[model samples]
Target: MRQAPVSLPLGIVVRRTPSVSRWAPWAYKAVSVIPGAGAADWQVLREDGDVIEYHAATVPLELWHTDTEAYLAGLSARVPSIGVVMRDDDESAHPYEILLATASPYECQDYADSGEELLELVPMPEGLVALIRDFVEEHHEEEVFVKRRRDKKRIDEVEDGRGDPRITQLTDVYRAPRAGRPN
Candidate 1:
């Protein structure tokens, strides 16, 4: 029997600092994730010097049985991280809109490849690490590697339609017709 998918509420915290470049005034990045946090979106959490951190959004960190391989790969990393995806929203007060938080690196790579959203890798909390580890332990099944054997038939033995039928040549059937030669 397959186990039900596990979901935990994760509050994503984003930190903003003054940018050195003139084009952009502020630089934003996801700093941390609060496990089981139930805070309102865009709520100011703390400020230190010129840096400001906000609880950008609370999203579910879901772990499905089908995605155990991805979760396992993430958990085995040197620094286990959770992916925070923020979309660009020009209409909103904040430049970025907080999207979902994911534990799978493959999913994060897909979003990053699109070049439409900002991706941040935040360190996963100890609790979340244990939770995801347990989920993987319960659902993950090792797949046996199968080597594909090549077919026995020799493709070079047959000369069926090897070259253009319009040009007939005994030695080099695939040679291009010379300018003076007739096709």
Candidate 2:
């Protein structure tokens, strides 16, 4: 049986703080995600001293039936988190562009492996957690472990193909070509 995919609109909360170093002016990171949030793009939420928080962007947080196993892994974690994926954007006002929000830790690892993307693990909201838990419960099935048995055929019975087929002599068939030897 196939199940339809689920999705929710999530708003990414990004915080930018003044950097202490002279090389960079600001440091940006995704702090949290708001579930069922409307469209937003770098809208300022708060400002204090040199720190500023913005509702960076709203993106679809999708949940697939096939990825329920990954979601299960995230739910069981010590601190269940939502992976916020962002990418660098030079032309945009913000340093990074919010790409997506995901509940799967496995998918988060994939984004992290890319190294080009900025990935953050924000604590999952209680409501979001409950929603994912319900989805996982419905779609996730405990996969059975099946050990694979080796083939019964004996490979030693066949003649190895490593020997040169052109050499008619059985003894010299396996002889490797020497330097300056024409054959």
Candidate 3:
């Protein structure tokens, strides 16, 4: 499939874990992955006053292109904003993080659906739609829905008694309440 050329305004956060040594003591190794200690490394690709708060150091966040259409469609229709998962690089016990932004509905939903990741919906920021408009128009194809027509010859009601064209009296709905009995 040919993908459209679109630029998304987003960044990722990563935590630099201390290098492990095969000869290191068990206690030292255990403390290295303590989950909270390494979380201080959370930083966006571009530092723009964004920071991860109380996020784990191991989980890696990413954005994929396949979900672009769903993101565009969803953002355009229902979802008001997007979400992100990372760590709050500051000193804190919690090593994992979930943040909300008004930019990436598709990526937000993708992470949210992972069963483990959490999402916090917020109001989409101004101009986010304009950024997505060009991309959506280039990639989204509105599905044409065709309604199936009902056959006019088919009986419309249960009382019509299809395949049995003979009409009976209302009192004799089922061949006179009793079989072999005259109404």
For candidate 3, the lDDT comes to 0.42
Candidate 1, which segments miss by more than 4 Å at Cα?
1-4, 158-161, 164-183
Cα misplacement distance, residue 34 of candidate 2 (Å) = 0.5
Candidate 1 structure lDDT: 0.89
Query: What C-alpha lDDT do the candidate models reach, one value each?
Result: 0.89, 0.90, 0.42
Q: For model 1, how does the per-residue alpha-carbon lDDT over 95-126 read when each residue is reduced to its tens digit?
A: 78888899999999999999988899999989
Better of 1 and 2 by TM-score: 2
Q: lDDT score of model 2? A: 0.90
Q: What TM-score quantifies how close candidate 1 is to the native fold?
A: 0.84
Tens digit of per-residue lDDT, candidate 2, span 68-178: 899989999999999999999999766898888999999999999999999999999999999999998887888899999999988776453357667676465565666
User: What is residue 100's positional error in candidate 3, in angstroms?
Assistant: 11
Best model per lDDT: 2
Residue range 71-123, candidate 3, lDDT tens digits: 67556666445454533324564344434232456565666677664444434
